[model samples]
Target: MTAEVCEIVITAPDAEWAADFTRTLVETRLAACGHQTPIRSIYRWDGAVHDNAETRIALHTQLIHADEILRLTNQSHPYKVPCFLVQPILSASPDYGTWIIDCTTRPEAI
Candidate 1:
């Protein structure tokens, strides 16, 4: 089967949650790499506009594992309404793409 790459972005309330979430994802092989960046988000919540600085984790994984990744994120996420966004990878370096596939693939002798 051909491998498909994807990027999943999830926002956390703080740095700690971002760190914990990234660790869990990597340990479970749901993601190959996760990058956390601080972001200032302004959005409407409950008819009121709110602005806050948040940490966003960008998870690099295969499309085949997206459902499981989303499920686990929602299950363990701290936010009442977490942001889970999936973006397809249009292009990437050949080596990095191969690495993502290798890291996210199911183990053969498992």
Candidate 2:
């Protein structure tokens, strides 16, 4: 692995779903923290263009555990084709970056 940390971006149908999933991810150490926002999404699906309101989540986690995070998201996310985008954290404050790595190293059941 090139780095020890990564950010996983995902979209949820609503705030409730994003919040619930964020809680689970944090508790299970799949993610150290999550940022959620309400967003307007316009996309083409099944040969039709659609516009909808959605929740976007940015999850911070250790690179080593990214696959497990995807596993959990795939299992619980409501979307038939959930978007799970993984981006390497190229730069961050040393202390902040360390904290993220530390927080996600320890796991707990919720």
State the lDDT at 53 in candidate 1.
Answer: 96
lDDT of 1: 0.88
Pairs in clash, predicted candidate 1: none
Model 2 Cα lDDT, one tens digit per residue, 1-110: 22888999999999999999999989877788999989999988889998999999999888888888889888998988888999999888888898898788874422
Lowest summed lDDT over 10 consecutive residues: which window, candidate 2? 101-110
* lDDT scores in order: 0.88, 0.88
How does model 2 score by TM-score? Answer: 0.92
Residue 96 local lDDT, model 2: 85
Looking at model 2, residue 50 earns an lDDT score of 85
Q: Tell me the number of clashing residue pairs for each predicted model.
A: 0, 0
